[model samples]
Target: MQQLTIVTPQPERPKRRLPKWLKRPLPSTEMAFTSNVIEDLNLETVCESAKCPNRTECWAQKTATFMILGNVCTRPCGFCSVPKGKTGEILIDEPERVAEAAARLGLKYVVITCVTRDDLPDGGAEHFYECVQAVRAKTGADVEVLTSDFRGNRAAISRVVEARPDVFNHNVESVPRLYSRVRRNAIYQRSLDLLKQVKDEAPDMPTKSGLMLGLGETFDEVLDVAADLRAVGCDMLTMGQYLQPSADQLPVERFVPPEEFDELGEQCRKLGFSMVASGPFVRSSYHAGEMAAEATS
Candidate 1:
């Protein structure tokens, strides 16, 4: 097998200007009905916390991916915008509130994700289990969980798996060589192990993972990561451009062209991912419901 070469990014790489393809129109109905529901229920969403480019479009469509375990994250990754430091106390009623918001949104496929809560003993795994259970009990909708690595705690990972979300997602984020800079506290192998555990615990459950491009990763590196995921029985994959959330975060290494995304998608398909979502605006939770449906189909 040929070794995939790692591209060493320069210490002071010039910021890549945003291209026209990345431009999105302002939200016409900024505070749509879904926004009101989430505000009323006092629920947090990754779409807002991560400052996802598709938030306006998803919100207008009255669909959202819920973010539990508080707004602040314990781990400070360079590529993420979620706030760092002490996240304060965990909200006990958060699970119920999340269920309420899902009910209000009338979502048939509910997606739940959380910040890395290294402050907690179980890494907030029990809270994730509770949220999945609450959503299922309330709406009887199919649930999908995009979770942290649980700090490689198999017991914590098992706790969430016991809840049995319809789809299990753990994003690899970037290539292994870029893990140190892009994902500070996260281990690339640990993420792969997390996804494998899902398949191990419940073979029938569809497992999913995501990758973000334009972080100075070579195409061979991206394909190698995809191959790694498929080897572990990962059923679905999402590949998208990594947009730097703020000036304080990691700057964008480059803006991947749309045509390149299509080429990547074709490569992923050949690698045996049951469903692949690849493009500039494709986030892990963007069109999550459709992704699950497609994966199962």
Candidate 2:
């Protein structure tokens, strides 16, 4: 096999001029509802914090992913916009609030994720588990939890697996070559290993993962990563065009045309992923529960 490489056209540092399209749409009524629910419960969410471009569409569709625990992260990565610092302290009431927020939103699909809380003994794994359980009891949404690796703690991971969320997501943000450059604080193989453990523990659950493109990642590397996920029995994957969250963040290497994303998604399906959600706007939790449902069926 010929070696494949992603030849990225090195773009200049960062463009200050925002494209008219990138200008955010006015906050819709749904954003208000979602915000109120979050604020009412005193919860934090990636949808609101990271400035995810999908917020208006996802919220308008009545789906919002929740960020559990506090918003402050223990580790900072270049590709992310989540606030990072010394995690002040765990909010004892957070899990219940998340459950309440799910109830208030009437969400049929809920995505729960948290900061990398290495400060705690269980790495906050139990908190994730409880949040899922709470949401299930309150709103009964099909659950998906995108979690940290718990520093590769199998026992801590098992605590989450036992809850049996409908979908388990662990995003390897980029390939190993770019891991250090893009997500320097994150360990590439550990993310792969974490997904493996999720599948190993909950084989019946639809296991899913995602990757961001245009971080100078080669298309072949994307395909190879897809193959790697399939080899381990991951059932679903999401591929999306990477957007530089801010000027300080990594710049986009290539536009990654829509046709190419379509081809990649089809090839990943051929590689044995039960389902693939691929597009410019797709994110880690993009239509997550629907894809997981498809995978199970």
Candidate 3:
């Protein structure tokens, strides 16, 4: 008879255990204080939203990367831990609240990032401008805005440039080849174009971009991406080991050693970047104020 053989599906392999260097100490009381400020003001931070490995360290130091708009992201990138779905009406008071949080935290420099709000008309660029203005007016702090691509809208990008934040950051997140798997809805070239546009409009602005290593990208591929950033006038770069946030996210392909990150940082410096931060715990905003100061100095 034409009976077919039964097929058995193989089980998925277990995730690799984190290396010793990836382990962080438990959150301190200062972290609780930072959490209380965010909670009291109902502010959102990428540190918490993305399940960042450096949340405890950053918060304990009384610094945070504020996430404007809302917590729900519109993109379903494979590696992010931020929740994705439809969001409510934009929080009109968010800018003011973010200002208050920075003031209360006694911050001299603030970094504001947002979820990809594709639902918004300007991709939440106006809100970013408002937050930048609000924080500057409220605390007189140097502001850095890490923004989404705004669907490649030039007008929207211009509006943010007009706000005149101290630093402009947009993370490429991964190399071009990995876009389909790592950044599902994002276009690699589109991101590069956005950075270029920022520099085009505001030539003196210090533009920055970040990359998450350990997602099966080659060492040469990482350097090529750094070169791409430099070609667009990107001034600062941050590279970090990508840790899978959870079981649902993409698994880690490799654990890049600490020395590799150091070497990459050196190479990027040779490519004419003014500032480079690369390490297992390096996020776009980690020690961001210090990096900005050194770059501008």
Candidate 4:
């Protein structure tokens, strides 16, 4: 006797939907004012460039992280949407413009960040120093600079540290296992080294770093990163869910629940981080002024 068996194949599961926690109202009137001010000054903001979900909220609050060294980034990090390759000529007057924009906005705490200019000799560290200086001189406000790894050049890191910004930030971005896929051009240890160097050079000046979740990292891995950050003397930490900037970017593996962010924040505090911002929409510079005040308070 012969028996024939036919097995039915299982159907594919559908992709996860955009969680309710991730949705928010569109920009308000205040956002228009901020947009006009930035546009009038011919400035670039990471809010718009990176398609940050919190843009409306941040802009309405009249705060935005100024993106210097032009809108184009040299690195092609899979999680970022900032334009990459052939960024054209550098804007020498950018520092002054940033200061002016901050002054116009009447900001008390100004945060400045830049594209990764690997093509440049100093990795744009000098320019970052100049921008921080200009912001301080013009507005007399507390300044924070979120910079690149400077290709692991101690001299370059020293250049920015010499400016003595109120806060020095360089995001580690992801865990070691995901570094290759999420941040192909950056090394995890090198980033940790950058934060450690900042602490060693200027112990009083707060050092900060950020990470994006939902990029296929495990819960234990996130805790490991928090421990590593603490080991390096990082004063502040920001953890947010990774939102895909575009169709071409890496897909989100899971939408970390808001409750999870609360738990992570507690864990970060346990690790001795003076300040921690963790949520679905928290970015490196989101509510940065408040974070700075909280950390120093």
Task: List CA RMSD, all candidates.
Answer: 7.4, 7.7, 2.2, 5.5
In candidate 4, the residue pairs with backbone N, CA or C atoms under 3 Å apart (3 or more residues apart, or in different chains) clash, namely none
Clashing pairs in 2: 6-218
lDDT of 3 by residue, 246-282 (tens): 8889999999999999999999999999999999999
Candidate 4 lowest-lDDT run of ten: 10-19
The Cα error of candidate 4 at residue 58, in Å, is 1.3
Candidate 2 residue-wise lDDT, 2-62, digit = tens: 9999999987665645434345565546566776777777878888777788888877766
Q: What is the lDDT of residue 242 in candidate 2?
A: 82
Global lDDT scores for all candidate models: 0.91, 0.83, 0.94, 0.91
Worst lDDT window (10 residues) for model 3?
Answer: 23-32
- For candidate 3, report its TM-score: 0.95
Runs off by more than 4 Å, candidate 1: 1-15, 27-30
User: Candidate 4 on 171-243: residue-level lDDT in tens?
Assistant: 9998999988999889999999999998998999899999999999988899999999999999999999998
Tell me the TM-score of each prediction against the true structure: 0.93, 0.90, 0.95, 0.93
Q: Write the per-residue lDDT of candidate 1 for residues 1-297, one digit (tens) a residue.
A: 999999997686566788999997877775579888988998888888899988888998889999999899988798899989878788999999999898888899999999999888999999999999999999999999999998999999999999999999999999999988999988998999988988999999899999899989998999999999999999999999999888888988888999999999999999888999999999898999998888777
Which model is ahead, 2 or 4, in terms of TM-score?
4
User: For model 3, what is the error of residue 119's alpha carbon versus the real structure, in angstroms, after optimal superposition?
Assistant: 1.2
